[model samples]
Target: MKTPEPNACLDRLYRETGLTLRQFAQDVNRLGTERGTPLKYREPSVYQWLQGHMPREAVRPLILEALARRLHRPVTSSEAGFPSSPDQLKQPASTVQGLIHLGREDMDPSRRAVLGTGLFSVALTIPGWPDVVGRMKAIKTDPQRRIGQSEVQAVSAMTDRLSDLDGEFGGRYARPMAAAFLVNTVAPYLKASASSETRKSMMSAASFLCYLTGWMAVDEGAHGRAQEYYVKGLELAGASGDRRAYCHILRGMSVQAANLGHGTPAVRLANAAAEVSPESSPRMRAFLAGQQAHSYALAGEPTNAWNSLREAERAVNQAEGQLGTFGGFSSATLAYCTAEVRHALGDAKGSVKSLKEHFPLRDSTDTQRSKLLFSSLLAERQLEIGHLEAACATWNTVLDDYPALHSGRVDEKVAKIRTLLSPYRANSIARQTAERSRELLVK
Candidate 1:
């Protein structure tokens, strides 16, 4: 029998799952590893899948397994468009069209869909997406009348609430809640009346809302949607003449590009951020440098990564000198950059150390959710390096204290741990942890 085209398979998968290519790849990888198949769900493989090339036999099973795990039910190849035999593969075009027809019936309107449910709940937990507070600080506030003050304050308060919800209820709750604020409250205000001062504030708030929305899309592994939101954020920031906001948007773009394996563009964008952020705070400069270092590391340019890391350190050291002008750098912020650099450099111990050093300094409020996330990321890195006990201990601590911190960035960490621990599932402790996490999901 003739082989099904890769694009046909890909189109079918999207139709069946409502997942973007990247999201599907991540899901495939996570589930594959967990099920002991270990398929490589790289970008090229996904592109090939979209073009109708059947994934390796191993990949086909992994895809089915992942869907079963995600949907909490048994799934068959026939349900996925591949039949049991070669002769079955010779099915008519209507067979394929019928699947597409059914997929459409299950499709949710993008705008009306809840932000953090299902796949997005898992997506929200990946490291490095900027948060609402960081985006807000990037925008310049008006010196005169505080026209956008109420809205800014509202967003700030809402961001805090969402962060708390993320820590307590998980990403699934936090995402939709945050998205609701953006679409229902913030986006409407962006289209409202304003004076020059109010306009700046409005732009700042809108840019932040857009950034948050983009972050949510990123968590769900929606790269295209994330890119669109980041571009819109950049435009909003530019309208306010906030170069810092522009820098933040560029950073978001860099992250998305790096994740998509477009490391060259990622590095270029990071460099542009570093070069143009003249008045950035020391912590902010360090943040940019660290991102550049990460991009370079991913590009396999070790020398460049090292140089950028050094630049990041220098920025941090000089932070004291510029304290009066730029405000003292937060230890948590500094640690976040340091941890990211170490993780990218393959220094798992260093990553854990940096995160531990910074974890204590994080705010007790939701603003410190990023720090908690870094700690979880460090744990995952440690697990990667074969430090299972240490990793387990770290996750246990996080789970004990912030059980609700299950979504946004924490879910990624959990998924990684789940994969790592899968090998030891027969071990009682590992089994307990896995079951605990699964149980938490239901809550």
Candidate 2:
């Protein structure tokens, strides 16, 4: 049976509102808050609507209530584009494509688009999606041997491969593969009848895979998907009794919330992470503090950002004092966070400085791709500040080295640059760079 399309439901809701996109979102936000369920209506949320995506689960009900207020009538879940329960969601015959389609429908629109666009590039880098039937067979009949040293080594090798793919190809290209491996390989082993030590190792491996998947999803701009993965990772980490991995997942969730502009939630999540395990290593504490600082920066709380950043730095210092290494917190990760926080605070120059520091530490092969992405971000900031020539030059560098990363984000970034440079089309360099990017985009 064909499942209902979310767009059809959304179209009906919009008709009931009788308002344009902006008006509808405003009304929804206002009514939603008045009804005691606040909804965030940011630009990215608006972008989701334009792409024909509906919010999932409780969000749908909140939106419907807002619409009902606007229309002066009652609305139901059926009218708002959602299945009433898991049973309905399960009723449809599930082909792989069907599953993907339904998953897309349930996902936030921006996330769906990000995943759809990135799937091709990411799938090519990892093993193909598992055959569900084959996976079931393996789960049912696989050997019950305890996880040995070899299994730990294998898991480590896989994690390294995932990390490399994330750096070289972008997160969109790595997440699904990680997800597949988790569902097909790791989950089964975790559930197997094995020694406690083996089960712990399996859970740890699965937690790491889940964390990687979450990170990749975040990179692809799928905040909701990233959140789900992180939550699952947190649960697995708990089962493994791995405090360090739990801290990592918490940090990841905070980052996702911050990226989505939910700074308060991000701060709360980060604080909770830090509080839960007081005796976590200095490096782990620093990582958590860095994430909290990022959340504060997004919240426009500069004092908090500065304080947390200082705390993170102090923690790093103490770790260095104890053992010449900063626990497991790598310099690259620290530099990336510094750049991110600066960018969020609208300090393009500071962001650029952090990026410069980070660039030297990135792998040689990743240099071009990383620079292209950073330059694109810097170019946007420059354009915001009315530096047209600098913006144009930055975008030119991005387009010139675009293929290095195979990133959908690069395409989106280039598009933004083109839009910014449109007014300066008569200028030779701007026109040439814009046209070249347009041509590459077309191909």
Residue-pair clashes per candidate: 16, 1
For model 1, residues 306-416, the per-residue Cα lDDT tens digits are 888787778787665332211234556667656766666677788778877877766544243454566677667767778777777777776664564445456666555
lDDT of 2 by residue, 1-443 (tens): 55434466667767766777777777667645533356768656744754556576545655665565455455666665554756445664322222234334323435555333221110011111121112211233237545554665677578768877876787756666666666555555554556567656666666677777767766765554565566566656666666666766766677666765657667767786777653766777677888888889887898898798887777766664222211244455567678778888878777766766775665444434456767787777767667778778777777777765656556678777667788888999888878888888877
Worst 10 residues of 1 by lDDT: 118-127
TM-score of each: 0.60, 0.67
The C-alpha stretches of model 1 lying farther than 4 A from their native spots are: 1-171, 175-178, 184-188, 191-193, 256-262, 278-280, 320-329, 365-368, 406-408
Clashing pairs in 2: 122-173
